[model samples]
Target: MTDLIKIMQQRQSCRSFSEKPVEAEKIVSCINAACLAPSACNTQPYHFYIAHAPEAVAVAAEYCKGEKVNKWVGEAKAFVLITQEHAEIPAANSEARKRDYRQYDIGLMIENFCLEATELGLGTCILGVFNEEKLKANFRIPSPKSIALVIAIGYPADSEIRKKHRKPLEEMITYLR
Candidate 1:
């Protein structure tokens, strides 16, 4: 149980990666874990595009490396593009609901990927500041599908997870009688 706690505590968004290449099996292992994340009504309305080769990864990174904030993306070894099947899932995208359950599902999936990556000694940085148009063009993403988030994964230059600060449980939660 301590090992799990350590992995949870140590997982951080890595901005820098080592020159050493990440094994394909490790990437697949993390993604396989991601595939098991729960979805809304079992819709599972999303897709993952993985870029592993240097040239392919670089191309994907270009879309996310917009300005100063996301410049760190260029250094990551791989980028996983998460796209939502919005048009196809019209029944779930109701504006009146004031909530996007699909987005919530996507978040769960991404977290699963991150946790698995951390467990396998890999690093991940989730990026949403990229140009969607460029992503669509670069990846040839079909219309009606939107790029929800991109995750950069690889071995970290510094394998240490920096200190994580969070509000105490009491501050963020309350029990009901």
Candidate 2:
């Protein structure tokens, strides 16, 4: 397997984090990696609002709560609100295949960020159970737009990357001849 494949297999959603702040330079580098991910016509329509300040991180964490599984997000030292803009590919490109392009683009950018963070020895968890409406209001975000994902990142305070249980290739794949 390739280095990227190894990285992908190693990445895990970290639930416990330490008080140690993620170095600013490393955070910037990871975000840069995300920006380099492919998008529709290179539209790069995703926006990442990073919250490193204690107060800001607190606010972001608040909106990420409301569920038992995500309560740990509050303890994270850094939070990123991943916002995706509505897709507006050029009119001439209207023939493009249908699907929510913005959502797909966001997924690529987020995986890039997580892979970079893992390579940097930082831990991350992609959070989706947050209250999007409240989160938007807290950030003064207008309604009707998409907030694709919220990610928690920091130094790990808990266990190492444990074994992941997954289906084997045969069960999940089909070889078409």
Candidate 3:
């Protein structure tokens, strides 16, 4: 199998992380990969902020709503906040279509970052249940965009916990003429 396929198969949402800190250069590489993701009309409106401070991670953990997430997020060595700006859509465009495409663009960027992190032997989890308003206030995100997602990064604590099960390809695939 190709390296990309191997990376995809091995990638999993890691909740337990070791105390080892991720290298700054590695994090930057992941973010660079994310920035190269394709976007609708090439309007890459996403912005990313990386927080490596322990105090900042603690603050973000407090604002996270998930109990399981709070336990793990608090220990993460770094946090990445992804945001997207609100753009005006042409009157001729369908609202649903515009929304769908923008969301797709965001998903692509997130996946790229995740895969890059995996390649770097780092663990990451995409978090959605965060207090957006509080994060903006605490993180001082300037106006023009809103949080899309947050990713917690660190080294996996245990290999067993890193193993992830996936649905069978046959079950997920739909063959159509």
Best by TM-score: 2
> What is the lDDT, from 0 to 100, of the residue 136 in candidate 1?
85
* Model 1, CA-based lDDT: 0.82
| Per-residue C-alpha lDDT of model 2 across residues 7-27, encoded as one tens digit per residue | 988789998898888887888
Model 2 quality (TM-score): 0.91
Mind giving the per-residue lDDT tens digits that candidate 1 earns over 1-177? 697787778788898988778888888888888879988666677888888889878888887878778887777888888898752445555662455588888988888889999988889988978888888887789867899998998789985667888888889998889
Per-model TM-score, in order, reads 0.87, 0.91, 0.84
lDDT of 2 at 174: 92
lDDT of each: 0.82, 0.85, 0.81
lDDT of each residue in 1-177, candidate 3, tens digit only = 998888887678888899898898888999999989988766676778888777887777767647554565776788898888654455666764446466678899899999999989899989888888888899899855688899989998876634567788999999899
Q: List the residue pairs that clash in candidate 2.
A: none
Off by over 4 Å in 3: 65-69, 87-100, 161-163
Kindly report which residue stretches of model 1 are placed more than 4 angstroms away from their true locations once superposed.
Answer: 86-99
- Which residue pairs overlap in candidate 1's backbone? none
The positional error of residue 74 in candidate 3, measured at the CA in angstroms, is 1.0
